[model samples]
Target: MLKRQKRSITTTLLTTLFICSLSITAHARRSGGPTPSITATPVVIEHIERNLSSLGSLKANQSINIAPQIGGRIVSLMIDDGHFVTQGETLLTLDSREQAAKVNEAKITVKDAERQLSYMVKLFEKRAVSQDELAAQEAQVERAKANLSSHMANLDYYTVTAPFDGVLGFNDLSTGAMITAGSNITTLDDLSTMKLYFELPENTFSEITTGTIIQATTDAYPDHPFTGTIDAINPRIDPVNLTFSARASLDNTNNQLRPGMLMRLNVVRPTIATLVVPARSVLFDGNDQYVYILDEEGLPQQRYIETGIILENKITITHGLAEGDYIVDKGVVKVTAGRPVKILSTEIAENHLDTVEPAGDARS
Candidate 1:
C-alpha cells in the first residue's frame, strides 16, 4: 500500500510540471519580445535640376610652331624661353650676308636697265632704233625689276619675327646652328585667353549652347576657381566615341592659367525637375541601385532608384521614385518588408529641419 502511495505522488508531480511548461509557452507567445525601433519624418520634397559633368584640359587660346621659312645658319637668337614678345618683334636672325649682297647687286642692275630703256625709247621715237631693239630693252627692264623684288623677299626671310603678341618657348635651335626650312625653332602661344576642350555624350547636343555657364578648377592653382562658358560646340559627333567636342573660353589675362594643365569641368546641363535625395540613403546592389521606403506602419519596402548627376552629398533621382515618399534611412538592416516596426526615441530622421529639433518639452 505504501509503494502504491509513492507511485501516485510521483505521477501527480509529473503532471504538474507538464502543465507549468504549457503555461510558460503560452505566456511567451503572447509577449513576442521588443520589436525593432525606427524613426521617420515627413518632409516636403522638391525636384532638383540636374547638371552634367566631365573632365577636360586647360589650353592656350592660340599656339603656333615657330619655324624658319628659309634654310640658313642661325646667326643670332634674340629671345630665350619664357620671353614675352609683341607682334613683329625680331625673334632670331639668320646669316643674311649673301642675301644682302645679292639684293644690292640686283638694285644696281635694275637702275642700269632703266637708264638703258630710257635711251632706247628716245632712239625709237627718232627712228634711230628698230621695234625689235626697243622690245629687247623693255624686256631687260622688266626682268631686272622682277629680280630685285625676288631678292628683297629672300632677304626678309632671313629674319624670324613674332606673328602675334604672345610668350615664346625655349629656342631648341641655338645660335650658329644650321636649320632647314620648316624646322621647329620655338613655340609662340597666346595666353591672354584660355580654351578648354572636352568631349560630351551625344545626348547633350541640344541641351548645351553658347553662353552656358561652367565652373572649372585645376590642381596647379588650387585656390582659384575659373569661370567660363560654352564658346563652341562641334557640329558633328565622333563616330567612334559617339561624343561631341565642347570648348570653354576663360580670360587668362593675368596669366594665372597655363596650358597642358589638367582641369575639372562642372558643366550644367538643361535643367529638368527631379526628385532629390541624400546620397547616403542610396544603396547599390550589383548593377542596380536601390533605397528603402517606409510604409504607413513604419515598415520597409525596397525601391530601385535611377540616379543622375551627383552634387556633393546630394543626388538627383531621375526615375523609379517619387516625391513625398517616406524613406527608411536608419534601422534598414533590422527591418524587412511587410514587418511591423515600433519607432524608438534613439533614431533620427535626416534632411528635415523640424524632425531634427531637440526633443524638449517647453512645459518641463
Candidate 2:
C-alpha cells in the first residue's frame, strides 16, 4: 500500500506540473501585445517630369505711343480708347494753316531762285555773267528747296496717323487743348497677338529651350488655359536678379487677352526616370529625409534618402532607394528593426511586391 501511494503521488505531481506549464504558455500568448495597424505604398519606377512655376504678366508684342512732332492746338481727335485703327490711318488732324502757309512761301522762294539761277546760267553761257554768280544762284535754289521740304515734313506731322494696326487708348488731349512737341496724345497696343514674358532662375537656365511648351493661367479667366511655346530666351542672365528672360507667344484674335493683366506660367523641364513613392511615406527630421522600408523578413528598417522635388503628390527619390522596395506609409512610428510581422492580408502583401514589377509580370 505505501508503494502504491508513492507512485500515485508522483503521477499527480507530474500531472500538476504539466498543467501549470500549459497554463503559463496559454497566459503568455493571451497577453501578447496587440498587432499594429499600418498603411503602405509600393515603390515603383515612374517617369519623373518636373515643372517650374512662376508668375508673369501679359504684354502686347508691340506698343506705340502717339505723339506729335510739331506743337499745335488739338483741332480734332479721330480715335479714342478702345478704337481699332489700321496702319497709316489718320488718328487726329491738327491746325496746319501756319505750316501750309510756310510751305507755300518756301515754294515761291524756290521758284524765284530757280528762275534767277536759269537766267544766271544763260548769261554765263553767253559770257555775260561770272561763274561765281551762277554758283551763288545755284546755292540759293538748293537752300530754298531744303526749306520747302522741311515745311512739308512739318505739315505731315500736324496730321497724326496710326503707325501700326492696333487699338487706341483714351484721348489724352481734347479739341482746343494746346499741346507741345513730343507730348503724348494716346497709346496704341497691338493686341492681335499677345506675348507672355517672364524670368526664370539662373539654375534653370540650361534646362529650357525654344519651342518648349508652356501653360499659362490668370485669375481674370479661371477656366481658360492658355498654351504657348517658348518664342525666345535671353542669352545673358541678369546679374542683379540672377535670372533670364523668356517669352511665349499666344494668339489673341478675339482681343480677349489684354496687356498689363497678371498671369502665371508653368514650364516643364526635362523628364527623368526615377523611383517615386507616396508623399505620406516620407518623414523628415531637420534636413534629413527618411522612410521605413521592409526587410526580407517583412520587418521594418529605416532608410535615409536624398529627395528631389515633389511631383504630383509623390516624392521623387534621388538616392538611397530603388524600385521594388516596400515602404510603410503608415504605422511606421510603431515599428522597430528586427521585429516579426504577420501580414493581415496576403493579397495586400503580394500586391506590394507586384507594384514595382513591369506590366504582365506576376508576383511569386
Candidate 3:
C-alpha cells in the first residue's frame, strides 16, 4: 500500500513538470514572431491660435433720432415705419399755409422793388436823379431780394426730410399733432452693416489689430454665430479695469441684427508657426504629459513633452518635439517603451488642419 501511494505522487509530479515545460516552449515561440506594426506620423509645423472670450454688444452702423427742424402742426406724414427711405426723402409735412403766404408776399414786394429800381435807373441815366439817390434805390432792391430768399428758405423747413438712407422706426404721433423744433419724430438707422463693440485686456492688445476678425454669438440666435472685422480701436484704455475697447463691423444687409444685442465674442489671436501633433497621441500621468516616439531604428521610446493651446484637435508642441520627428499617432496605448516596432506606413499629412476663419464669409 505504501509503494502504490508513492507511485501515485511521483506520477502527479512528473505530469505537472511536463506541462510546465510545454507552456514555456510555446511562449518562447510566440515571442520570436514578427513585431507588430505601429501607426506613426511626422510632427509638422502648423499655425496655432489661442481663443479668447468677451461680452459685447451690437450697434447700428449709423443711427440717429429723427426730429423736426422747426415747430408746426403736422399736415402730412410721409414716413413709412419699418421701411427703408433714401436721403432727402420727405418724411413729414407741416401746415405750410402761413409759410407759403409769407413767401408769396415777399415775392410781390421784390417785383415792386425791381420796378422802382428800373425807374430810378432810367431817371439817373437822364441826369434827373443824383448818384446818392440812385444808390439808395439800388440798396432797397437788394434788401427786398434778401428778404425773399430768407422766406423761401424758411418755407423749406416746414417739410422734414431724411438725413440719410436708413430704415424708419415707429412714430407715435399722427397728422395734425403739434411738435416743436428738435422734437422726436421717429428713429432711423443704417442696417446694411452692424457695429460690434467689445473690450479686451491690455495685455493682449499687441496681438490685436484693425484687420483681426472676431466671431460672435447672441442670446437671441444662439445657433447663428456671426463674424466681423476690427475696424476701430479706442486709443484710451479704461484706467480702473485695465481693458481697452474695440469696434468691429459686420454685414447686416437683411437687418437681422440691431442695436443693443448682448453678444458673446470669440477672438482668435494671431497664429504662430509651431510643431504640432494629433491630440490622441498624448497621454497624461499625474501632471506629466508624454508620448511614444520612434527612433531612427524604428524603436519605440517614451518622451516627455510640453503642450500649448489645442486648436482643431491638434496640440501645439512647445517642448520635447521638433518638426519632422516621427511619433506614434494611433494605437499609442499599446506601445511599450524600448520595444521594437515594424514600419507599417507613415501617414503623410497632405494639409495641415486649421480652424476656419469666420471673417469675410457670407452672412449667416
Candidate topping lDDT: 3
| Inter-residue clash pairs, candidate 3 | none
| Residue runs of model 2 more than 4 Å from their true location after superposition | 1-32, 236-242, 344-364
lDDT of each: 0.80, 0.81, 0.83
The true-structure Cα RMSD of candidate 3 reads 14.6
TM-score of 2: 0.81
| Model 3: how far residue 80 lies from native, Å | 3.2
Order of quality (lDDT): 3, 2, 1
Sliding window of 10 residues with minimal summed lDDT for model 3: 355-364
lDDT of 1 by residue, 95-151 (tens): 999999999999999999999999999999999999999999999999999999999
| Model 1 C-alpha lDDT versus the unseen true structure | 0.80
Identify the runs in model 3 with alpha carbons over 4 angstroms from their true place: 1-46, 275-364
The candidate, 2 or 3, that scores higher on lDDT is: 3
